[model samples]
Target: MTNVLSFEWKKEDYVTISGMIDESSDFSELFKKNHEVLFLDLKNIHRINSSGVRKWVLALDKLKDVEIHYINCSFSVVDQLSMVPEFLNKKCFVESFDARYVCENCNTSQTVTLVVGFDIQAGEKNYTDGPERLCPNCKQKMEFDHNPDSYLFFLSNLSNKKKTAI
Candidate 1:
């Protein structure tokens, strides 16, 4: 069993949340209370689903101009986060905030990332865990892996897009 804690508040038209986030209404209702940036805190959260992604998208649509953020999410959650369509940066800032580059060949339909971490500097960079997505069957670098391009892609584009953007 897991203990779930959540955080949500309207800060100048933004719903700030920090805790377990699933396909629950604790957020939609908050949206109804007031439309703002849907700030979701994945920092302490452990799990989520496509349904959770759907909920975030719906909330963003209904609220319009609402920004969603999921911080410090687990790697599994981060993997799912990366695959969500239109989900991007403003909503998916991995703790330690790392940037991942995607291979321009796999086409995103057949890539599965095993581990993720990164380091960077002016005109240079470094990352561990094989660059975000790999072929689940071939053990080779995949060209693409659905959407999200990276975890940050999810937090910034969680609504009205739902697919790879740029």
Candidate 2:
């Protein structure tokens, strides 16, 4: 069975989405005529299927005029963002997201939160360096679990779009 997606409004401009995004997911309520800015928190999203991706892209297209700030994106959300070009638009900006890190010594894995323009710069083709993450179990530093290039592919795609528009 697919997990039900839920939406909660923390503020007039901020909203949180949790659970799974599938064919049944409905984002109609988020489509507003006068909503100028929106902060979308996707930290708790665990899974997304192809149908969900279609729905998400359509929803984003509707909000093309609104400035969207995506925050607390989970690994699943990040994966989709990297793979799907239509997952994000010119008006959409990623404020923060999580990256998987693993400790070589203890083999303990953890998700590190990275802020855009601070921890990592968007629109850069290469992202070799990231903020140092210390392992909880061991004192040694942890290494990023995924390849920076593939994980940050969306940033490069966004950058290309900006360049072509200029």
Candidate 3:
């Protein structure tokens, strides 16, 4: 199957990426051809493979001047962000992203949108002591799906204050 990357022009200097990224993603051509794009929004991306990861890292390594802004990131994307520190180096920041929780009593799942610098602790990889949600099915307090230290590991490398919507 052909892996396709879709771009939506939000502005002359910004573009939103929606779709899966794989070995076929040629960001060099896209970035080289469109030098005006300084911001990339990865809110709608669904999945990315190892090859995609390698290609993305390589592309970003070349484009150090470009800033990446992650918004509405899916769980898979969050996993990648948390796992690979270079996936979101100092030039990158997350505006909003998805987080998951589970209720042990009912086995129900919940997904929450976490805003950077608000829901997430400043200078840390964990959420703030904000509101807690009850499981819809069992009315029990939900637990975070992943460990904060491990799941939000990407924050250690990210500098969120740069040109972000935060």
Candidate 4:
């Protein structure tokens, strides 16, 4: 069975989206109001397709005037953000997201939350310097699973945008 997308409004401007974001997902509510800042929680979003990406990009276009903060983004969402330039607009910011880590000793893998400004620094070459994480099984240091440069590439784009906007 396909997991249908769902949204929960935690506040007037904060909404949590879960399940799969596909062509059928409706984003009409996001464009209904004028908000100074909108917070979107995407930790539960498990999957997204090409049509979904197109639909999401179109929805974001309508929200260009609003400052969007993406919080608790899952690895899937991060993948989209890193791969697609249009996935993150100038008005959008990623507050926090999950990154995959693996322990080579025990072959254990886990996901850790990384806050943009705190855990991640824009110009820093070592993106893995965030909170020290140890593997649950082996009690050994876990290394970042993906390439730091590629997985965190969106930060460079965001940093460049901020510099030009200043």
28-74 in candidate 2: lDDT tens per residue?
87985468888899999999999999999999998999888889999
Q: Which scores better on TM-score, 1 or 2?
A: 2
**lDDT score, candidate 4, position 165:** 13
Which sequence of candidate numbers ranks them by TM-score, best first? 2, 4, 3, 1
Off by over 4 Å in 4: 123-132, 136-138, 160-166
Higher-scoring candidate on TM-score, 1 or 4? 4
| Model 1: lowest-lDDT 10 consecutive positions | 115-124
lDDT of 3 by residue, 1-166 (tens): 2247888777776677777889888775446554522656666778889988998899888877766666777777888987777787556667777778889998888888887777764355464343366888889998887777777776656654745442
**Which has the higher lDDT value, candidate number 1 or candidate number 3?**
3
TM-score of each: 0.43, 0.88, 0.76, 0.86
Clashes of 3: 0
Better of 2 and 3 by TM-score: 2
RMSD in order of candidates: 10.9, 4.3, 3.5, 3.9
Alpha carbon lDDT at 10, candidate 2: 92
Report the C-alpha lDDT of model 4 over 17-109, residue by residue, as the tens digit: 988888898899787788878999999999989899999999999989888888999988989998999998889888889988899998888
lDDT of each: 0.43, 0.83, 0.71, 0.82
lDDT of 1 by residue, 1-166 (tens): 3434355544543333454456663554555555344444343455566666676666556655544444445544566555765444433333222233354454334323221222211111222223444544455565423233353343333333221111
The reply for model 1, stretches above 4 Å from the true place, is 1-5, 8-20, 32-39, 89-166
